[model samples]
Target: MTDAALSPLRGLAKLRKAKTRRFSSFDRTGGNDDRLHIEPGETVVIAEHAGAGIITHIWSTLACESESFLRKIVLRAWWDGEAEPSIETPIGDFFGMGHAQTRNYASLPMQASPEDGKAFNCYFPMPFASHMKFTITNEAEHDLLFYYYVDLELHETLDEDMGRFHAQYRQDRPHAPSEEGRTNEQVLFGSENVDGKENYTILNATGHGHYVGVLFSVYSRRRSAVWDWYGEGDDMIFIDGEAGISVPDTIRKPDPRIGPKAKLIADRAESVPGANDAWPPTLHGTGTEDYFNTAWCPTQTYSGPYHGIIAAGGPNWTEPVTLYRWHIEDPVIFHKSIRVTIEHGHANGRSDDISSVAFWYQSEPHQSFDRLPGVAERVPTFRAPYRNWSAVVNKTRS
Candidate 1:
């Protein structure tokens, strides 16, 4: 880990052999043309590197006439000449915000800076063994004015234990509810979920790596007797495999004369379904607000280092909200696989516009992603909720 500037220890300032380098959109002929003009339907290779290295930072700013340009433009990265990219998502969503909108917010690993957050920055460490490439594809109508930098360090060879950084986008333009014609109480909590098959998936990855973080955005589409609060959903994360606890037979098999600890472990294992029959959840949380480290259905925006609600909705969730949780200090580890999911509304009851960007690190040979949503679908749509008082948000600015 790199030491902080305030810390007494100087880690990187000491004996680091990695040489610093950067790729930027600078004009070659010594003129003011310090930006690239990317035409519509054009894909531009932002950076390409040979040999082992680690990308430490990425900074970019874009200007286009179309409002949905953020969603239309895609960012992709490949490591070691992989057929499929390790990092892929809409340009706006890749910088830690979603919904094709940019706003002022900051996080430990990523940030959208001031001036209405037009500047996007990312600090995730992306290490490549043999080769690395990053590209941006503009699928919008108008041409793109883009300025960016890919900062990195060149090394003779990277450590074998280093994992490649990855990010994948997924969405459900208002997911389908559990059952129609159900009362508010039934929709909220009356149902029982034994298998968790009906939950909304954030990511289903097959690899040996750690899940670092996720950015989740939601748009409330309907008014409910439950007050249109869209965060009753609980977060459930399945590690290794699904359905049941995955462990060696001796650890959970029926055995007599086992120690107290071993017997308790066995009994707990018997509580769930068969081991291979299902994907067992290793981490489970309370309501949606709780999972993001907030309480009482937050309607106010807050940005922190690890967890934050950059764009909170109106009262009763009348609009959209974008929240994030980075597990830099507490990453979820999995040996074989991991599945991250959450209930739409208690027991997967409510249907709302849900989308997410799952960010993690894994070894090579990762699965290919599903087809990215079209430009129309990638941009968001909202349903105006009932009577959000206009005066409540009128702050007394100094």
Candidate 2:
């Protein structure tokens, strides 16, 4: 096949034998009332399919009674009847921005659309062999008026080569400025990061799969009036056996696509210290901004198909910033395990509010995720809520 055959549109010339379907929250009475009402602390299963199929698209918008509705509302999904959900995260985060807020930004697989970014859409291809389920839980204080549509294609058979979709949300508000009487310049930049042990972890998964993307958000809880640039931290990813998977290379399954595979030296002599242990990781990036495909300290918002900055923070990066990097064209493959991390500051120094939603496809049963935080903990907190955002706008006007 020529390179043209690789184009997604090229397959349209041939007809397929799959039945397309959609599950929506439509009024059964055939009225214009096309919304689902979910009371406080209620869980609703939007769709459930029993058979081989692939969920191709999902679109949703909602009205909630609480201000932190995005974080209070949670989305969960299961494939092939796994007791644990393959996907679980806050609604706003799942749509591709963070801090329990939304604005217009479009990624190849996900988007929070216009009308002020209230519309949420996802285009990830999720395949299931026996069954699939999707649910939404409203942990908000008040009721919810939700509108949604789940689109999928049904088939008699599916290839086992494809893995299931997984997305996880995580947050840490652990760092604060030093009280050791140091200048802001020294506090932010003067530190040595030897190993990435103290970095903010984005994804730590065990299985045969590839990491596809990251939705990283940073909120500054700066207590001092100084430069708050936290992007100096480097991005490091430990692959396979390097991530501390003691499994031998002989037993692990080969990756579906052709590429590099992790090889473990299972027969290490007890006499040799740290024999052949890999260091510095297989994937390392220059800085936090560099990993997200931006440079020279982002000061504005941008959204592209692969990588973009959705919420470029203000003055000295003192506010909150949202960035996304999707490895659709270049997924980090791992046969046994993968550890994706980035420093909070150069050499693990500054502590800022950091959160992320890592999305990928992995063979089931996947690693168990840390317990999702409650509403009180998951709610996004802001440090620079400057009204009219004059600093950012006037910076543009000038």
Candidate 3:
């Protein structure tokens, strides 16, 4: 036989390796009924793999009327028989939607498709050694019906240095506002933040891993009298370094005898300490919208593979909004630990409902997660009053 003809045949033989075959929902039912009906308060273990493997894709569709059902239904996953789940978040938020609302959006690792964004898909590669388990907990009072297919590939063995996927959800009903009577401008401009102690924490983990990104949502509760912008906060990420030294220990406290300008300079120069002096964050973002890859008070919805605003609160920012930012192209790497946080408003001075799902990959035996709040607490209750904030501002300022 000619060498050219033999070369093509040789390539086919190498591609037929037994360890590279695909196993998915199609294989489970042999192409028959594939949907699953979940009762309220019930937990279903959807997929289980006994050896090294990687979940390549996840597709699911669910029907539920409760607007809050998105936050009520929780998804969790365990790797290597860990006692605590490494992935836990409300299904909708986990899928890229927030505030239990769905709409069309696309990202590198996740996407919500057509038909009113009912079709949720994820493309993150979740690698597990020994075994992996995925489950869904229906916390709604009404039953939920869902159809899903988990596409995975079982390999003879995973690489020795593979990190497991993880996701954690958190919420701050109303990010405690600053002292009463403070004007929005005052709150946004009158702060010296050498320390990020009060910033809203997205993820606080200790391990060898890299942060992928986060799915964030906000429900504005700022009264119409104020400039209702929720993104003046800066993103402060502490990765494998000291967050900062405490102001008291780093520099002399402001002296009353000093002039206002000198005192201001002193305050501005003071440093803030974080959880500890261990490893400080290496990544920091200028502002909320800046971190999400947008700027100058975004009011329109847009989506991309890396970062986008899925929901832009209506005129004058009087609506709930959700945004996603995946670091696939620029993953935040860390060797020892990481603490991801951001300000609620400039210097954490705004009170707005905020929730987020932080996604990352890390070595196994991760720190156990705190108990996820019950359904009642997870439900988003802050809805902006239906009024044009612009009118309120014009009347108050004019």
Candidate 4:
């Protein structure tokens, strides 16, 4: 083999050897532990923790350097307590890539230097709470420094308890001919049905991704289904506005292709196969069988305040399903009962034979509607009301 091929093998071996002995000390208190030290000139710091793993809130500064000149400054973490570390590269499915690695960097000063350069902060959730390591490397030669902090405490999030998530289609009647796609389904639930006393939080999503489906809408009996919570179809933690962007129209699924269209577009943009020299290049939908083309559609509200599970893909061979987790963030303020209506078919009046579905939410608050004030019957609303939505519009959205 040539030197280039052999070079990679040698590099891999070195990385493997350096994998062990990553972290200096494991401190329980959230205080400075000088044992975790690095040479001022050194670019990277390797940290290791057993069982607890390593979760870090990292900040990077480009001292005396322009971001363009700063080649590669990244956060690398290894899963197995042994194999060579892996940098949390941008989102891609090349080998070991999953959730998009997010960054929060400070604004760049017109004149960049050590006294005042640019900085970026990012949060990392390791693969597991097992043996882990963290390293930050600066490929740039300029004197750059990174501000690092570690969080030993696992940030607790409100537990999601979706009570009585039941789905009963227009009763699969006994001794009746089964319908192909028109079994006319009703995936319903109530927040009060949940078991635990702990309240829930609401998570609304929108936007595009693999296996994304149409009719990604939410509804409650209280307000009109005029507004839908949008998402980018990925787990992006947000504090305000819509969690994800809504696609105005759902693209029809074309014939499946062999490779990902998004990848193909990316290659072209680079000028090798086809490259578009855009900072954020255009992403072509993989209208192929492997990916879905549903993009930019409005999201349905979880009705009052309900928790919902936005999931996709499973062992079963059917259209993907998303289960709604209710009363998650706050009390699902209900004038009446709450039910989430979903349809696998096209929202523009097209139809399909949905395969499987599931739902769960707590209903503890409404042990008896008679006791709660103003608790009444509410219905589903839709801009273009169809099926269950149409039936509930007049009685609800007014």
* Root-mean-square deviation of Cα positions for candidate 3 versus the true structure, in angstroms: 6.6
lDDT tens per residue, model 4, 243-291 = 1233454554432331122211112122222111221112211111111
Q: Candidate 1: misplaced stretches above 4 Å?
A: 1-9, 174-183, 242-280, 384-398
Q: Which lDDT tens digits does candidate 3 get at residues 1-398?
A: 44336554575554433354343334355766566668888999888878988898999888876667888889999998898999999999999778888899988889999988889999999998788899989998888877787888787788788899999999985455555675556666445555678788898888888899999998777754656787888888877664434334355454333213223222232143334323233555779999999999999999887999989987666678888889886888877778888988876877788899999999977878878988888888865375565577778688
Best by TM-score: 2
List all candidate RMSDs to the true structure.
7.9, 8.9, 6.6, 24.8
lDDT of 2 by residue, 82-121 (tens): 9999899998888967887888998889898888889999
For candidate 1, the lDDT comes to 0.81
Q: Which candidate gets the maximum lDDT versus the true structure? A: 2
Candidate 1 C-alpha error for residue 169, in Å: 0.5
Every model's TM-score = 0.86, 0.87, 0.84, 0.26
Runs in model 4 lying further than 4 Å from the true structure: 1-43, 54-56, 66-70, 88-119, 154-398
Model 1: how far residue 318 lies from native, Å: 1.6
Deviation in Å, model 2, residue 204 alpha carbon: 0.7
| Per-residue lDDT over 1-398 for candidate 1, one digit per residue giving the tens place of the 0 to 100 score | 54344343455356778899999999999998999999999999999998999999999999999877888899999999999888889989889668888888999999999889889999999999999999999999999999999999999998898999999999995455555676555556545455567788888887789999999998876655344578888888877544444445454442233212322222133234423224235776778999899999788888899999988986667766899999988998877778888988876767788889999998888978888888888888765555544433433111
Clashing pairs in 1: 174-352, 242-278, 242-279, 242-280, 243-278, 243-279, 243-280
* Pairs that clash in candidate 3: 195-272, 237-281, 238-281, 239-280, 239-281, 239-282, 241-279, 241-280, 242-280
Error of 4 at 82 (Å): 4.0
